[model samples]
Target: MQPLETRKDYTYGTLEQNQLLENPLEQLSVWLEQASQAGILEPNGMTVCTVRQGRPSSRVVLLRGMDTGLVFYTNYLSRKGTDTATNAFASASFWWAALERQVRVEGQLEKVSSTESDAYFASRPYESQLASAASPQSQAIERPALEQLVMDLRTNYPERVPRPEHWGGYRLVPDYLEFWQGRKARLHDRIVYKFKGGKWKKERLAP
Candidate 1:
């Protein structure tokens, strides 16, 4: 099949160094709020990339917390978990097309404390809790069998569902972050933050 061609000229806005918050996380918070206010669906959605044995994989996940850094949850034995276990490093990115803005983060990943995972799991909806408990993420299973597993879990735990040991959260401690803003004629703006000397240093990159 022949490939199709398409293009868009971004004329949304410009990004200036003076407009950035001294702290990259603060700047991210501001952009996230704007993305939400702009009516973007799932503004917290991000693409997380992990490497295993020199091969990389990517998937979309919701941003769940920022108390210490960017936090997300998954099965402890999932592909992502396996990758992080061996490599310890990962990257995540967020793109708000409507706002013509993007953010990228590279960092080391570590599992959140079991207590934190338990609290987050407990707060999830009852159905969601059951689903997480039933599904073995990144594993292959027949559709009917998966459904039956969920039904059995639901029947067995009518009131309270205990968080599974394999289900938990991971936090990415960033050493690098970049914010990109699209501009007219494709002359986009790129601002980068690097953690060095126990502080964050900011710089700009050419589009």
Candidate 2:
């Protein structure tokens, strides 16, 4: 057996209360834009986590919408959808390693209105729309059958693809948001916002 050894120091930047906006959404938008400007690939990519039967599941999903809350789309019958249905809450995290930064969001999930879902879906690429419409999501299918299904969808909907009823968006209204910045000497900065008493409270945490 062999142990892999690797390490690096992070001194890209620091985070402070004065640098943050009073609203976490504003802060998140700022960081998200910074990552995009910094040329980090897929700056909107995030790991979404859900719990089911007392166990947790996580997967990387691209963030498709954000305003007052974060939005992502998936098949409503997928495993994650089932988990969220039972839990009605989830956590998401974004890590931009090149920027030595990470953001964590924990919140309740809400289905976005159908109109909103359609608007986003309509904006997706033609193939993406076809893929989503063809896939059974988490359901099991034979390899050839799945490939055939996709091909059939492409042939059938060569011009346009309609959004599936099961395929839509979910928004996370975060009550807890954490912004972490890696620092030199292994010391890190952890700033968090907690929604309490109908407002957000800011605090620093040990890392």
Candidate 3:
């Protein structure tokens, strides 16, 4: 192991309790906005971790929407979906290094209604809609064959593309949420909110 280098000057970016949002969702939104403003690549990208029959798995996915809960779209028959069915509990993380912030959420996953999925699918680009209909996500296939299928799909549906039954959205209802902000001297700011007693309880954690 190499000797650690020391001797560095730093400043603290302390976040006071009053500066934190009372609601974890609201705070998450604020950080997301900041990330967008800072021009982070794929700011809405989040890593979703789920358990499958006692095994852990995770993948990065784009966040589609969030209000009372976080929403993301995927193929209903994909690996993630299979895992979610086996274990509905999941955890998600968002890191925006440019904004020096991160947010972590652990929650229960639920399938969004078909009506909601239909509406969102309708709003997608025609090519994306066609691809979703043609491709069986998370399944292994020959690349050339898959490309040929996509080409055939485009020729078959030159205009509108119908949504696939296997493609839809899932919403996560958070039970615990945490926010972290980088500060000087490694004394970062950390706050956590947990759902309990039918209400949210907030607390601060040492960095």
Candidate 4:
């Protein structure tokens, strides 16, 4: 058997010639839209990184929604959830190589209201709702036991499954946002927006 060669050309994309966006959020939205148009699977998927005291951890989660802030859902008692409790600060990043774009955001997280959680929960699939109720997120258990628990819950609750009190949404209100575009000769373009004194200041970063 022959060892596989690892090489690819990235000359197909050019970032310098692309028009610069006026605002960072607008730029991110544009790139996100382009990623979706380019058929990148789960374009809204992002990695949420949080620190528990001094230990850093990260997990991939679907972006349920975002505006001025990035929103995601999870069990409040989960590992990431507990980390947020100890340290409210977090960072999230989105990468879509097909579009040669990435966006990174750092901010403090805050819990959304129960009303918001209720609304989102009501919209989830019935199976997902049941699983959410059955699973003790971030807790350890035997695989078979967990599956049996889910099966038992499904059998017991064939109708409406109420949202667990531990489950909810969190919003990361970004104070810093960076947009990166892959460029030629490894000179990537990086534009950062920092919140300062009731206004946003834009700056270029060394790559």
| Best TM-score among the predictions, by candidate number | 1
lDDT of 4 by residue, 47-124 (tens): 999998799999999888877687899999999999999899999999998867788999999998899999999899
Pairs that collide in candidate 2 are none
- Per-residue alpha-carbon lDDT of model 1 for 76-189, expressed as tens digits? 899998999899899999999999999999999999999999999999999999988999889999999999999999899998799999999999999999999999888999
User: What ranges in model 3 sit over 4 Å off?
Assistant: 1-12
Rank all candidate structures by their TM-score, best first, as comma-separated numbers. Answer: 1, 2, 3, 4
lDDT of 1: 0.93
Ranking 2 against 4 by lDDT, winner:
2
Higher-lDDT candidate of 2 and 3: 2
TM-score of 2: 0.95
Q: Candidate 2 lDDT (Cα, whole model)?
A: 0.92
- Candidate rank order under lDDT: 1, 2, 3, 4
Displacement of residue 145 (Cα, Å) in model 3 is: 1.6
Model 3, span 1-207: residue lDDT tens: 866886443342556667888788888888888788889999999999999878888899999999778999999898999898878999999987666778899999999999999999999999898888888888999999888888888998898777778899999899999888778777788888999988888888998
**Each prediction's TM-score against the native?**
0.96, 0.95, 0.91, 0.90
Tens-digit lDDT string for candidate 2 (59-174): 99889878768999999999999998899889999999989999999999889999999999999999889889999999989989988998999898888898989999999999
Residue 148 displacement (Å), model 4: 2.5
Looking at model 2, report the run of 10 residues with the lowest lDDT sum: 1-10
Better of 1 and 3 by TM-score: 1
Clashes per prediction? 0, 0, 0, 0
